[model samples]
Target: MGTITQFHLAFPVRDLDEARHFYGEVIGCPQGRSDTSYQDFDFFGHHLVAHISGEGRPLQSGRFDGEAVPIPHFGMNLDRASWEALATRLKAAMVAFHEEPHLRLKGKPGQHVTMFLFDPSGNALEFKSFDDPEQTFIP
Candidate 1:
């Protein structure tokens, strides 16, 4: 069997402290390393670093998939149960979302349930799950 390796991703945040509170306190990702300009978080089984984008300014986002999705975003590929749990967690946090968690492309071959969120930096991230996991790579 093949193994999916953990990965690392970084994005811009307006305030490092806010990112710390969101990712560390709210989202509950463990802290990795940090400095005055940036902080690293253990996101699921991956690493996410939030860095200051120069001056204190809100991060910009883009529209995609019928929503104002953040352009520079990243997230993990989670299983069905974990994906549902994360959606519950996000709702409990009262996190303002760009797109709510829902089944996308109903009746389609790659039908999936996906949710979009933003970090403290306004960077978009998505966590998705498929009813048939093996269909993830179906062409």
Candidate 2:
């Protein structure tokens, strides 16, 4: 792959300290510059900023592979090993999963392992790994 560009996302969180602990300690993202109102993290090479706000968007659900998934979630697609490692880490930390880690789309073009969870501020995040990386965009 050529020079992949990093994406930036700024989202709301209820508290800075809670965001710090979750993104830094639980998720293992190296923190960047931060202040009383916002915190930045290196989310798998992408830039993620957690800004303090009263509350975030309301929760909604959508269906995927016969499962209910939170709408408007964000996350990264990792290789198999990294995905498994993160899953193990989250399990050990006892983070409540919005959707348990499991393989979906079996025998299909985009077969993959996936999991979902919410941050302390209720922002949904998903982590997944395609069985065949090349099939990431397959319809």
- Candidate 2 regions exceeding 4 Å error are 1-59
Each prediction's whole-model lDDT (CA): 0.68, 0.72
Give candidate 2's whole-model lDDT.
0.72
Q: Candidate 1 residues 1-40, lDDT tens each? A: 1233334355778888899899989999887546665676
Candidate 2 lDDT over 23-68, as tens digits, reads 9899998886565556668777775667666455432554456776
What pairs collide in candidate 1? none
Model 1 weakest 10-residue run by lDDT: 1-10
CA shift of 53, model 1, Å: 21
Write down the TM-score for model 2: 0.58
- Count clashes in each candidate, considering only residues at least 3 apart in sequence or on different chains: 0, 0
Report the C-alpha displacement of residue 86, candidate 1, in angstroms.
0.6
